[model samples]
Target: MSDKKLLLLSSSREGQTDYLEHALPLIDGFLDKSIKNVLFIPYAGFAMGYDKYEDKVNQPFQTIGKKVTSIHRFDDPVKAVEEADAIAIGGGNTFHLLKELYDNELIDAIRKRVDQGMPYMGWSAGSNVAGLTICTTNDMPIVEPRSFNALALVNFQINPHYTDYQPPNHNGETRAERIFEYVRANPHRYVVGTREGTALQLKDNKLTLVGNKPGLVFRDGEKTRPIQCNTDISWLL
Candidate 1:
């Protein structure tokens, strides 16, 4: 129950960046000796498309030195998460991910598995599930989420790819700023910005960084600041 490892990749892991290419390889590293079976939980991309987010989520295991058996579930969901050595969730829409997790009764299964030391990896919307509340997610709720309580596996809310780059047609503040604003008002929460090509690695109760970039932690109304990464995580060490 204590050897679990989690690699929560920010949204852009599917993006075409040079260092982002290391995404899958880093995932493979988690599966090297500890992981034997893999469960591909494509709940986030539920209604979107079976494209990059979902395929990329599973493709890493199919090609690597490790031969992982994948299970994609829209049904018989409970059995899927319960039978795996590891669980990988892909990115797309955060609401959709929450819906599927609730509808399929996979939330309890996932939380239980993760608590039991199953290696769990998620990207983007998938990664959003790392925090206690799904409110920090930047994705517009195309559909109402089934639940607002995230897995609460970590102590902070994760705003993956926290960019100040605001695109036009957006209503108010940019997604990043909106998240910051929301958390600012709600001072009880802690949020971390997992930038592109970077990941928050939680293993054996240790949280560390992987890929090329480091994550930024934001609190209060202050701007996000980068912390030194790539070292033993004092948090769980």
Candidate 2:
């Protein structure tokens, strides 16, 4: 497996907190001290314009003393990835994000750079594409991507913004139940149900779950497992 550095977050905010407030510390620590310039991928931002999305992320990075350049600003998007010391993807619609990645032919470029050890960070829909496929995303398939395949920076599939909550009188499948379907269909694969406020960190080839709440793990023919904070989950790698 390639040595990839990834911080996959469930959500940018925790509860009703400010945008990216809860994750700022994590973001600061994930980025390399030498990484002054970060390449921001704003493709997942469908409803909101790219400029607004970039500006939203810009605030937090400025607080961390880093400069963020959105890929959209670059005429040669692939070149931007090659030169970036770090990469960050904001959360939005998974399908739209994948479509843009494929449209711009950035999948290979990003995978190569991250495999070479450039630190990568993503939140919500952004984190969804870090997995093998976008099949487990919680987003509606408003747009069809060339394929469901994604970055594959990690071995397991991630269901970000995972929750056990079910509204009263709702007959739809629970989040866990939806993930179970993926587990059954892809028996060999493992799915991590990362709740809001939680993140899965991969550093030095070791994967760990961070945040207060435990993340649920789904494997074929196995009882669902709960991964606590600071727990090593490299087996999923």
> Listing every candidate in turn, what is its Cα RMSD in Å to the true structure after a full C-alpha superposition?
3.2, 1.0
Candidate 2 TM-score over all chains jointly: 0.97
Worst 10 residues of 2 by lDDT: 27-36
- Per-residue lDDT, model 2, residue 35, is 82
RMSD in angstroms, candidate 2? Answer: 1.0
Candidate lDDT (C-alpha), each: 0.71, 0.91
Can you tell me which runs of candidate 1 are displaced by over 4 Å? 12-15, 18-20, 34-36, 48-56, 66-75, 167-172, 221-223, 232-237
Q: How high is each candidate's TM-score?
A: 0.84, 0.97
Against the true structure, candidate 1 reaches a TM-score of: 0.84
